[model samples]
Target: MSISVVILAAGQGTRMKSTTPKVLHEISGKSMLFHAIDAAKKISDDITVVLYHQAARIQESIEAHYSGIHFHMQDAVQFPGTGGAMKGVHVTHSKALILNGDMPLVTMNALESLMQGDADINMSVIKLDNPSGYGRVVISEGSVVEIVEEKDCKPEQKEIQTVNAGVYCVKKELLESYIPALSNDNAQKEYYLTDIIKMAVDEGKPVHPVIVEEEEFKGVNSKLDLAHAEEILQRRIKTEWMKAGVSMRLPETIYIDSRATFEGECMLENGVSIQGASHIIASHIKTHSVIEDAYIQNSDVGPMGRIRPNTKLINTHIGNFVEVKKSTLTGVKAGHLAYIGDATVEEGSNIGAGVITCNYDGKNKYQTNIGKNVFVGSDTQLVAPVTIEDDVIIAAGSTINKNVAQGELAISRAPMKTIKGFFYKFFGEK
Candidate 1:
């Protein structure tokens, strides 16, 4: 049988209080919408995401990440309500799984349980400690009878701790039939997807309750809920890393993005944090180098090289015995005591300490070019738009503003002033 997943992502999420669409908010590193999509892709061959309210932005983002998934617009403006929103979709499938876009923590295993087609209809339900604002599941004789929303439930129904988790799997033909019969007679005048449960019971259709572990059904609705979901995502990532032979100095203290990839035996020191689309491909390290929450794409580092905190790199290659601090290195070998930024260090050069290539010139910025095998003196400053010829030497404390000839020394300094008995003269005021 063909299995398809339909993800509902049309809600505007006024409660989130942000311009970004609710499903687009990130948990750990992956967007909430993408997390749900990835889980669904593992169990189903075909997946459709329904979008609205910033639909263009959501579609573009998802297309960039997963280009093959089908996209559908709920078009709340035209369709008017939830029931009518899905009216025209036609799929060539026997079964489909319905999911919400904001539940990022739902795993593939949890979804597979609901897809076991032994029952005519399966719905995920979880028992909540305080199911105050949720729809409570009503069961009699171990069979699900109905689901009552908090507002529509009677006093006794409100006390039922078992709540519907808004996930369902059913025969595609059954869904097509009942979806058209749904009514908007409820208080909000909005078509409630929950109504299908009652419709199934009335027709003597067996509804199976697939109880989900509390963690698998957590949904993100507000900023607080987003944070809670992110914590779970981080723990999952850390556990996977540990299983793959990567060592985390303090796993609980470190926060790694979900998209980060690390090779085996990589050691993240205490207080090390990796963020963005970064990866370390087969690199070893020693303690004391703090790699901050920066992006490293396709790079390797040698042991004892210090990656100063907050250094951002992309498509770059790094070597050993290098120390980078507060700079952005974009290409190969841009390391090794390299004071790069607002500067660029070419391949294969030893950047001496106290050697600064001055880039700022009062009103505008400038560049400095140093040739191969050039010895820059300690405390030397090469002013911008200047070049040091190959095999040239710059004297100590020189402030060079002009180019130097190849294989020659350039020095700029005021003549030293000397006075005999200067110390005695200063005391006598002579």
Candidate 2:
């Protein structure tokens, strides 16, 4: 059977109180809508998203990752809410799965369980301790009877803990057939998709309820809920990495992106953030280090290192307070307080403290190439478009602007002279 998934992302989410759209808010490294899309894609590729309120910005942003996703803009005048969003969006199949964009914690396993239920309609419900502000699920004997919105429920229904999770699997024809019957007679003056529960019941169709865990169905509507979702995601990420042989000092403090891949034993200290496709193998990542879009192997990096994009390290030691970007290093020891960008350092090179590769010359950027066994002294700056050949030595506190041949000692400091009374003449007594 062809299955289509419709994600409802049209809500303005005024409760979030930010100018940014709610679905665009990031948890871990991806948008909430993409997380939903990621799980939905596991089941079906013919997915349609109903969008409104920053729809173009949302579309253009996630398209780079999920370019195949189809979009539908909800008409504010004609179609105005969850019910209207489903009615407005187009589906390609007879049966479809409907999901909320803000529910990032909805797993593929939960969705699979819902689809496995043999029924005309499958509705996902979660048992909540405090289910206020949600549509309560009304179950009679062993069957689901109705879903009462919080505003329209009676005093007894208000006490029901099981609530509608805003996820469903239904025949597209059945749902579309009831779209015209949805009434905007509620407190919000919006057509709710939850009203279809009563219609399914009236038609005597088998409306099976799939009860999911509360955490899996948690929806983000505000900053607090977003934090909760992020916490859940972070824990999940850390646990997965730990199970895969990545050891950490403070696991709770470490943050790893979903795109990062690692193999072999690795140590991650507290406050380490590995983001955006970073690959590490058999390396020790120390405390307070940040790495993004880089590759490292058989190396030790920082208590406070920052590895920027497009950098590669092999058997390298990037120590405290060092930042590297767009560079490649092989067996290079850069121990402290240096900035290297757009450069290549060969094997057996020692990059001393406070050294900088001056890569940008105002309008253009250039590369600095250092050959094998080169020694760059402390407080030195290699002005870019320069090369240090094999066995070259750069003296301390020098600013090297030109290339040095093999086995040469390059120094740019002024000649030292002895002036016995010059200090007295210049300062008159310090």
Best by TM-score: 2
Q: Model 1, stretches more than 4 Å misplaced? A: 77-84, 150-159, 282-338, 341-349, 354-430
lDDT of 2 by residue, 233-258 (tens): 99988898899999999898999987
Clash pairs, model 1 backbone:
none
Global Cα RMSD, each model: 5.3, 2.0
Candidate 1: tens digits of C-alpha lDDT, residues 130-200: 99888889988767999877889999998899988889887888888988787778667777677778888
Kindly give the stretch of ten consecutive residues in candidate 1 with the minimal lDDT sum: 340-349
Model 1 alpha-carbon miss at residue 212, Å: 1.2
TM-score of each: 0.77, 0.95
Give residue 414's lDDT in candidate 1 (0 to 100). Answer: 87
- The Cα RMSD of model 2 versus the native structure comes to 2.0
